[model samples]
Target chain A: MKPQGIKVLQLMSSRINKYLIISLQIGFLFGFYLVGGYLQKTLALPVPGSVVGMLILLIGLYLKWIPIQWISQGASALLNHLPLLFVPVTVGIMQHLDFFSGKSLWLVPIVLVSTWIVMGATGLLGQFLANRKEWDR
Target chain B: MMLLQMFFWLFITLLLYVVFRRLYQLLPYPFMIPVLTCTVVLVVVLTSFDVSYDTYFSGGQWIDALLGPAIVALAFPLYKQRKLLNKFKVEIFATVVTASLLGILSGYWLAVVSGYNEMIVSTIISKNVTTPVAMEVASMTGGQPAFAVIFVMIAGIGGAVTGPWLFQLLGISNFLGIGMAFGGASHAIGTAKALEYGEREAAISSIGLSLCALCVSLLGPLLLKWIS
Candidate 1:
């Protein structure tokens, strides 16, 4: 076949696979929804469907049924946009700014400091665990 | 006015996405800066325009609704790290329990010193979890879920921006340390950032973060009630 013919074939194949990628992502989302619903109903849990679906998908991946790279692309893309997902939430926080007036200023520093300390300590602890012979090997 | 707010959100969203894509190319981890900065800018701009959060929030809730799904997807990374997790289960278990306990105590202690009332203090305990969990904990404990969500958001944005700097200042360089710091401080969003840097780090961070939140949700109220 001519180079153009080969080029066309490549384009066609890529296009077909692109849809595959999107379908898989949607499938993962749906799986999350279904499982989330079941967990919510059966367990009387607050667990959402999407979360359960994600766990299911992760299990599938860990078992080697699903490739890490396959979902990683889509997952990373969605994860990258995490802030956008919370835009409304933060704006809502701004809405409640009045609640944090002079009286609440102290809370910010306290939360900030404690958050830093706890996080810092946890981080160091993780490192310590990782370095331990029992964990490192 | 609602339409205008939606347009504003859309505009900011597009601009931020484009800017973050560029920054990600240059920096090892640039997502937090854009995310935190965008939040600050968006809130400032919206408030300046005199748009009520109700109007802005309703417009933005479309994204907020997806927050739960986004977080649940983190199990993928958690799942991916099973080997490492298995290797460190004992340590991970120990660390998680301790981390969660410490996280709750420190958070509450700080809230108390910060002069927050009982209701606010209850909300602080759940601030480490994802919105849905935090909201549930808040309602059950008699604190405002709305307030908890905001405090959580502030913690997330604050942690995402400051996490890296704090690590460097503390001379922490291991990926595990970095990931835990991000997860512990910022929860899911921070874990997402950790994943970009390294898989092991991301997994540890993700587990550490969620575990801490769950522990806090259970213990925060108990401690608060006892103290009061």
Candidate 2:
């Protein structure tokens, strides 16, 4: 092939891959929203659309309609930003401190310390179970 | 001044994200540290400025709205890790359930001794679970749902930060054990952290966290009510 033709082909392939990735992330995000919405609307279930979307996506993967690598890149990028995503929520939590005034001020430390223990202990339990015999891989 | 305040918050948030991304690129242990650091910085800044939680929350809620999308996006990792998940479904469930029970009891007991009221105690009881599910548990048990959000975030952040290290400390050599524990303790945030290790781990963690949350939300409250 001519040099010019080779350069053009390379550019095209790179552009295509970039677009492909962008589409996949958008597709996953949108699919989550759609499934969440449809389920809530149809079933009148209390679960959020996002949660439902997650379940649907899980099924999609198990069914083999989508490949891992295809979704992994976009998902990881989002996961990395997971903490950032909650920044606003944390702020909101702080802002709502007034609601906890009076008898509620006592709730803060209790909630924080208790939650920490619960979260930590649960993590440990999961580890223990995984260590057991019948469950051992 | 108000507009400027809002601008600074947004600017700081984005800047922190960039800094975190860069740090992750440079550091071996990237994910947990960035999250913890960002949280601390936020607390300091908010307190220093005497920023009312309500004011900050109004601005922060804009960001909070995105959490749903981010969580739903987790499906991708679950998809990627399907093969491993299929092979280990039962084990994941057992571990997650046990973890969920322990997490709820320890958290509530600690909070009670610490002098928190009934509402606060109930809220923390299901803090590691998702907001919707947690809310259900809260209302059923006469806990406050609004406050449950705070408990949930704290629990999740705590789980995400300490989960991996704890596993290493415990000499947990198994992937299913590590992943399931993360889910049961941290919910989506922990699962997000797990996804970094591998797709299978993330998928299993997500499933474990969600299922445990569902069970706790439904059954936990009923148990509480019955006992009371």
Candidate 3:
């Protein structure tokens, strides 16, 4: 009940509040993900649940039902560390070692060339369209 | 006891990833990206110790579980860029759809021509999309989901590493174009690389990545059915 005791209590409460906020933000994200999974299962949608979750969140933002600050910290934290989530899956490649043998020799070249073609085509077309709109102005 | 061991190994995996991520930044090489280095280190350690992936996954699935939430988090960036997206919506959609189609067809044709089997071809065709979507499409098309993931990783990492150089070489200086190319061709990994260019580039890349996934998921099964 002294001044120092009250000050320490306030600091502890503030720290707890910060943790509570982050948990809420993360909960909101996972809530959307669960809803997405439900939709994917019930509706038989072609899209993955995560993409559907993203769309739902985007719509919520657009409708102003969800404030950006509520989720920004949590979302950015996840996005920043996104690649780490993929490490286990990447390591799963070892399971497919047999497939990488003689018959699959062309996998690398095919993937590389296809990616290059897609990139070039998309970039050129997008740039052309943007430039055309500029000239129209 | 099992739960404690799982947590311990998972912690080790995460710690190693953080260390390698820092190393990658300090070294700043394309091949030294955290995911690649972490996977390699873990693989070597696991193999050396004779640990199976199933055991590792028992621990590592916690990180994997976040993939869904991380993807959903993309909405925040997409929301921030809504205005720019609205302005170029039609052009962006068209470019992505066209490029995705091209990517699919080219990969399929090349794989078939190179004497690969139907499953391999089907898997490779969906490699431009994000991992989950690619896996779904692969499953639907009778392709191996694991193979699809491998191909997707190759596409993503290759695109991320080469995208900037390729764009410069082609004289495509527009941020929108660069972002689209990276996203449409490489998916999430390329989008991450695009972030290095700037926020605008990253935003557009996110759009590109999502749109590419949408197109591939909707069209992939139909295309496979038609091809077969």
Candidate 4:
């Protein structure tokens, strides 16, 4: 076979395998999500099912019930493309234009100030704690 | 033609996001974050073209469905950071709890002071937590999920943009401090930005957000009821 033919074959085969692995990883993550949703329904937990699923996954990985390699690829693919998923929801802001106007004009400044306040206050406190001589690791 | 048009919006979203993402990578500008840019452009295009939100979402919902699984995937990074988490457990845990409480209380106070209605107050109250948890918080606290999302976005984006600068101004140089700050205040979106800073920061951020979500969910309703 020609060198070009061999190169093409290798590319296709590798790409195909990568896709398969990624799909499997996504399946594993979906399983966790299902369990989480089930638990949420039964327990009436305040936290969302997806979050609960995440905690379960963390514990699974920690206790070695789940192998990191099984989910790593899928997890990263989802995480890296995470922002893309939120695009639709973020665009939902169009429906609520009324919130930015009339009596709600204050929403802008309030959001801005409170945002700064949270980050600034936590940031300052985090620094103070990090610098403490006692907790030094 | 109808089928093509149905898929057209989805195609446009993917194309725009890829283009903007590539551009952000090359330039690395903070405000030009792909999510922000893509949403802004999509909204402008949809509004100017007189296309309704429902039409765009006909295709957009496919992407939206993935948000749940992505939430589960958050465990990956948190697991990776198990060592550091174990070491500084006290500090990280304390800071995020404080962040959740402060963020809710401050936002609540501002809305009350502004004389906004009960709905607005509820929506803004859970703005600190990630979207999933924030939505639940919004509903429980008598806010609209839609409005709560906007506040969450604002908080996340604001924290990502100002976080580093604020840390610098406040003299917090450690990655742990910075990551905690981002995750504590902004949750998922902030953690996403922290990824650009460093791996350690992103890892810490991942856990920071998860814990923050839990804290806000458990405490948001109780706190809101007490205050109001």
Q: Give the Å error, residue A110, model 2.
A: 5.6
Best by lDDT, which number? 3
Provide per-model DockQ scores.
0.54, 0.42, 0.71, 0.73
RMSD of 1: 3.5
DockQ (model 1, Cα)? 0.54
Q: Lowest summed lDDT over 10 consecutive residues: which window, candidate 1 chain B?
A: B28-37
Give me the runs in candidate 1 sitting further than 4 Å from their true place: A1-16, A46-51, A62-73, A134-137, B1-8, B23-32, B54-62
Q: Candidate 2: misplaced stretches above 4 Å?
A: A1-24, A41-46, A64-73, A96-137, B1-9, B24-32, B46-65, B111-116
lDDT of 1: 0.70
Query: Where does model 4 exceed 4 Å of error?
Result: A1-4, A133-137
Question: Once all C-alphas are superposed, what RMSD does model 3 give against the true structure?
Answer: 2.6
Put down candidate 1 lDDT per residue, B1-228, tens digits, no spaces: 768877776666658656865665567464345566567677788789886777766566666655665666677668767887787777777767766666667877777775667788778877766666678778888888887777677677767767777777777777667777777677776775676678788888877776666666667668767876
**CA RMSD, predictions in order:** 3.5, 4.4, 2.6, 1.9
Model 2: per-residue Cα lDDT over A25-133, one tens digit each: 7566766778787896799665566788777766777777766665676666666577678666655555565666786666555544554454445555555555564
Tens digits of per-residue lDDT for model 4 on B200-221? 7887787878788888888888
The best-first sequence of candidates by TM-score reads 4, 3, 1, 2
lDDT of 2 by residue, B1-228 (tens): 777667667777778767865776688473435566676677778888887766666556656656776777777666656666666667666666676676677666777677777776677778778777788778878888887777777667766766666666666646676667667767776776776777667777778776877668666776555533
Q: Residue-wise lDDT of candidate 3 within A1-137, one digit each (tens)?
A: 69999999999999888778876887789989999989988998877888889899999999999989989988887888877888877778766667668857569888999999999989988899878877888
